[model samples]
Target: QCQGGYDEGAGGLLVSFYHLVKLAALSDRCTAGVMPPGEAPEEVRIKVFLERDGDLTIPTLYGLFRGADWQERETFDMYGIQFAGHPHPKRLLMPEDWKGFPMRKDYVQPDFYEMQDAY
Candidate 1:
């Protein structure tokens, strides 16, 4: 019924493949929302727990949805949320060797901006 909503016998939140770049941070966590397609579109939100240094790995939908491939990659490139099991799982925007997650609230601005920068 909802992304994090109660579903009988279904544990854990259901993920929605998003068309919107609705990424945000909490006190110690991050969240993103994507629209799940159906007879009509429904909103789905995922709340992720930040691991050491703010790394978050989310399940990939590449096997289920085609568009997920690019969106998840872009999300990973921008927000640093790795889409686990994604076939290509590569950066869609930043350079391949770029360090740190730019979208993260606490992501430290690397002093070597001249070398690589999301700015």
Candidate 2:
């Protein structure tokens, strides 16, 4: 998961998970996603953005389960993407008791939170 900057001056934060399958594939090195995670259901596509000197490349795979089913739910909740074959495709961040996507860039941060100490 990654968080883009709120202001134009700050660079965005990029977060990635290193799965055991990936370690085995890369023989223990870091990697990045070349394509967005939503592209393929049967494969996990990752791009190796950085590696030891003389070793850098993009790679993709067709068989890898990186996490529990709920993990995909969290990704969906935060990023608003559907994992085609994931089980229990339900809201994981917003309460089942609430409404609408809260993490979207356009979501208005509630003024009450912003103004609480001003009064």
Candidate 3:
């Protein structure tokens, strides 16, 4: 997968975890791939950009999952990359009723939160 800002236009490819692991192990530079979660196979795999700062900075990805559940939900929670055939694609953090993906660059924080103030 290409980095966040780098748009190589993947044309939509279904990347497997095994492939990602192999790429990460073989290459020193960062790579990107799509991870799908749950029974729903309709989800699209967006390209992700890995950051050297430790966190995988996905420019187009965003969300809030509980830190305590990181290990169990890391793939789906933070990255929003769904594991196509995996079971249980529910909220890893926050309440079940929570609306919208908070982490996306296009996410609009309602009411008191203003986009301009974020900078």
* Candidate number of the best lDDT: 1
Better of 1 and 3 by TM-score: 1
Steric clash pairs (candidate 3):
1-32, 35-81, 35-82, 36-82, 36-83, 36-84, 37-82, 37-83, 62-103
TM-score of structure candidate 1? 0.52
Better of 1 and 3 by lDDT: 1
Predicted model with the maximum TM-score: 1
Per-candidate alpha-carbon RMSD to the true structure: 13.6, 14.8, 15.8
CA displacement after TM-score superposition, residue 53 of candidate 3 (Å): 28
lDDT of 3 by residue, 36-101 (tens): 332222223344444322443222222222321333244444334443333455667644555554
Put down candidate 1 lDDT per residue, 1-119, tens digits, no spaces.
11111111222222233342322322113224433333233335555444433446768767766767777777677566677888998887887888875765556778775564567
What's the residue-level lDDT of 88 in candidate 2? 70
Model 1, clash count?
Answer: 1
Q: TM-score: which is higher, 2 or 3? A: 2
Which lDDT value does model 1 have at 50?
41
Q: What's the CA error at residue 116 for candidate 3, in Å? A: 30
Report the lDDT of model 1 for residue 73.
77
The clash count of every prediction, one per candidate, is 1, 1, 9
Off by over 4 Å in 2: 1-21, 25-63, 66-68, 109-119
